[model samples]
Target chain A: MATIMMRVRQIAGIALYLGLANAQEASWRSPVNVLSRKGLVADQISTIWWFLFSTASLVFLVVITLLLIALFKKGQAVPKGPVQENSSVRPILYLGTGLTIIVLLITAVYTFISMRTLAAPSQKPALTFEIVGKQWWWDVRYEGESISANELHIPSGEPVHFSLHSDNVIHSFWLPDLAGKRDLIPGHPNSLWLQADEPGTYRGSCAEFCGVQHGKMNFTVIAEPRAAFETWLEHARAEANAAVSEEARVGQAIFMQQGCAGCHSIRGTAAQGEIGPELTHLSSRLTLAAANIPNTTGHLAAWIVDSQSIKPGNRMPSQKLSGEDLQFLLSYLMELN
Target chain B: MFRGALIIAGLAVILHIGVILISLERVKAKPPLAMPDTTGRVVSQEASSLLKHYGCGGCHYIPGIAGANGKVGPGLEQFANRAYIAGHLPNTPENLVHWLMNPQRLEPGTAMPTMNLTSTEAKLIAGFLYGYDNDAR
Candidate 1:
């Protein structure tokens, strides 16, 4: 018996260690993990979650213990005509009800306090970003100047303001690790203020069912130091670089001649169209097609040839171009950085 | 009572099948737009296919085309009936072909883009637009 107990203890230890290791490695990076918080707003919410969880767990333990005791402790069966409560069970019932009420009142008060804390930021926001939720993508702008798509950059350890707008339909912006969901209604703007305590990348997505590609509509929030973020913004505000390589020059010509210039825009060039996301710094973005795939040369080539296959029902049409022209186009796009 | 319930169930099955057949018939019916008459006018028929191939339906609501319900641009249901192209140029066959070729040159800063349409393709599209109007009348 002693040996069996020792074996069980060793197995339990290994299970606990594996569980903790998995939580630390994977759960912190998951956007929906409310417990692994990196922002001030998320921290407050986590506190509330922990409070409610602990209280509810204690109540569960007490109830389960009583249930087990009642099951084991055999007693004379009560007559079954009219339900009669025994005097012994009366005390247990009163104790259970009283404990339940106290837990409920505490949780209610805690939730109210957290809600008030989450209502506003502690300090004035140092930066403001205007985000327009387009169909299957996000258009991010800083002070109405530098424009980017599907990526938002901000300085860590400071409150950052966001003004959300929808170009077509209603979409809900949700980055669970940084803040709660905020709806972006067309013609009706909504504002949110969030602050990250540390420098990290938080993934966000459209929570509302806007259209067919709602699940593919994802964005990234990159938090960095103040100086680095400012430097990055300055670069993002500039226009595209002039075509340097011979292939890139051919690619630029193809971009203008083909229908690619019809719906997309690249600043510093004459390819201005408001129908699709701007590709002024196409090479700099971390992902493509609203974070559905990584931004790689091969992936980009596949996307340019047939974006419909990558994301069905999207706005970008499949291009009909020769292999050489496509290579030239890819070269020019890579030089935009 | 069981017999009555069985009779009602039988009637419900028949009604469901009837509704499905009617809906299938409606789905098979042709759209309410005049197609380009394919009588020796091969360019117009090819132009209609080109419009779908170029994904024009992704932006404009062109009639007689399946899945062309886009709301970004104005509907092209009665293209030949419009007095002016893009609200300025007089609607003519030649003018329409030019607009289709170089939309940016005619109206600078216009949302209409200069696609990679050849002169022949532009003329074909114009012919199809006029042919559709004549067939409709």
Candidate 2:
């Protein structure tokens, strides 16, 4: 009997663990849901939102009840005739006005208190990243470090600072589940603090109406444990892996010679152009073209050959490469882990 | 009846002038092309229109182009008088044409992009720049 009881307990524990793991995975996939906040700043914001929502709902319910009473109550019906100076009418007006003032005052105080808490992080940020907004992509980097595009990584349970700037037009940095929207204006840098309570992935996007591809300007933030984040940073800082196979080697040569090097950069190689995103560790990223599409082999090839069809009016013109050369280039790019 | 006719005619004239002025403001002038000068360079207005079409005014401030007051790149007020194209290549017409066609070839890491201009388009743009410079002088 004792052994059977222990076995049953073990099975229950395993089931509970699986349930929690499934819940965590599901929450990450819920994109930009403000109420499902996973960060410190977002927690505060959602608290305020819930407070306001409930208060407003209560007010609405009360108002509707009063309206129904006024409409249907037989003896208490408001007089349609003007200047009757009814005793009941005067008291209702005063009561309604007083209640509105009191509710407004309470809401104002609650909102101000909640807003003040968001001004600074609970703890000092261990890492600060400079996030630059371009025409349709995000450039994430630390000072004097290697650059990554459209994806950000931060350690959970601690604050992360971000200094935002725009290279061209005004763009807004908004991670709805983590923090509020902050504008990145050219010639004017802005700063924000965000913290994730748990390790998960959150979707972020440009909130401002920038240009044609504004809707497609999306990014992902991956929150991990401190040790895992450190490992990632070390790997990302290193140069790209060298092409090994013969086809990949030929692809690397074609990339250098065929004007691809003119726009993109692959560190430790001759392709040092900085006009577009760095391609040093392209294979490791989750998405492509500012998170417009999945980072798959087929999508990468389509993007290379005809990026305009995927995203019209973007800066990358469709390349006219031979089928063999394209295959080779794809192989080489895939090796950039 | 005569007085009403005169008033209607005056109002029509004023409306016509207003329409013409509004159109002039809305559409930047696409003037006719001028003949090739002594230097064998053909001055084409189509090239000036092309500058607007390609949104070059979003970066470079070309003279005499309306709404071309972008502060990203240096102003092209006297482009012909510049000694070097992109501060490196000599400012000859042939070199300028080549630079326009393939800027990355000349300078590997320039912020100026390779716009994939055909040879003819590059020549026309070069002609316009030189012609505008001459006019400014």
Candidate 3:
């Protein structure tokens, strides 16, 4: 009885472990990896995809049927003796050619109609955003406001206009759940419009191959109600509040003393380096390093010590600081919100 | 056919050379100004390593430093003759040291990062920059 109980307990533990593992895997794939239709543009694109897929599948089935008939039908086989033309051969050829033309013309017309619909510009946009692609990151700026990076906040049920530009090389802005990918070309300005139907966080990526760290260049689009979006924007536009705690104050000093301010800018303080992302109101963000890691104190400290370890070839250099200084800087950055 | 190909190649070479000569003339129109050692101070040779270790070369262009041709920040060539540091602060030895050590305090939104350098290191770097001769370029 004792051995049986022990065996049952071991099986229960294994079952629990497997369940937890499955949950973790599901969370990783949920909302982030799926091709979603959470926005107006995405909905339209999804419809077009369905239409194209069904039509292609029909064409594939028809071709396969013809091939099978040609292979298996004894009557259609090559002549072993004298060749003779069948009465049905000419009509079959004519019918097949006419059907192919009709199908192709229909597919072309549908494709043109979808293209025109997607390309039509919005009459009036509720907000305008300008996103400039850099070597391996994004510089996102709202019209006539302070610049932010990696994350964009927009209001649900409202059309938003985006003007894309590239500072160095070509990079494509793709928010698969919100809109189509648009190229950001140097010396040329391209625009797109998108609207979210509900409140949710959608992931975006740099679709074009830009540089060494292109795969890691990710961003988030947070959709909320208009009132909430306005509130967030107002707060983002203002300078960060002063450090309140003694530890935070020490971290603030260390931030300036250690030259952290040279590459990252925290608006209320003197750390105004433009080569990297803006860190003002950083605590409010869910992730760091362009969503490569979660925004926890441990992750932030690790990133400061060796950014290359987290995301190799990123512009932020690895820093060497004492444990005390590192703790202080982490505390200071956490309090920026 | 061979003769025609040779003439075409010659015209291509001439066109390439003509483009190069035109660009070179354009580059010569504005010559870089000379920077003199106004303070007559000597910088330690160790300052170069300090600059590299601190990642100063990751943003600014400093002469005689390997991998220091970063275009993010302005070049340090003829830095002493410039009337201002960061386009605002007066060019003085003391000001340069202060700016190097704590740039954010001096200018809030300036792109120059505040490197946490010791007073001695800041002085050494400032001396090297101020004493840079344009002839080296």
lDDT of 2 at A17: 42
Per-residue CA lDDT of candidate 1, range A206-245, in tens? 9999999998999888899999999888888888889999
Tens digits of per-residue lDDT for model 2, B1-137:
99999999999999997786555543232222222432331124346545544445544667645545444457776677889988878989889889878776887655454566778777777776666555523
Residue pairs with clashing backbones, model 2: none
Compose the digit string of candidate 1's lDDT tens values, residues B27-95: 231122233333343343355545644455544666544445544457776677889988899998778
Per residue, candidate 3 scores C-alpha lDDT tens digits across A248-322 of: 999999998888888888887788888778888888876667755555554565567767655678888878776
Give per-model TM-scores.
0.63, 0.64, 0.63
- Candidate 1: misplaced stretches above 4 Å? A1-32, A80-88, B1-137
Fraction of true interface contacts that also occur in model 1: 0.00
Residue pairs of candidate 1 with colliding backbone atoms: none
Off by over 4 Å in 2: A1-30, A75-87, A144-146, B1-137
* Shift in Å, residue A256, candidate 1: 1.8
> How does each model score on lDDT?
0.74, 0.75, 0.72
Give the top-scoring candidate (lDDT): 2
TM-score of 3: 0.63
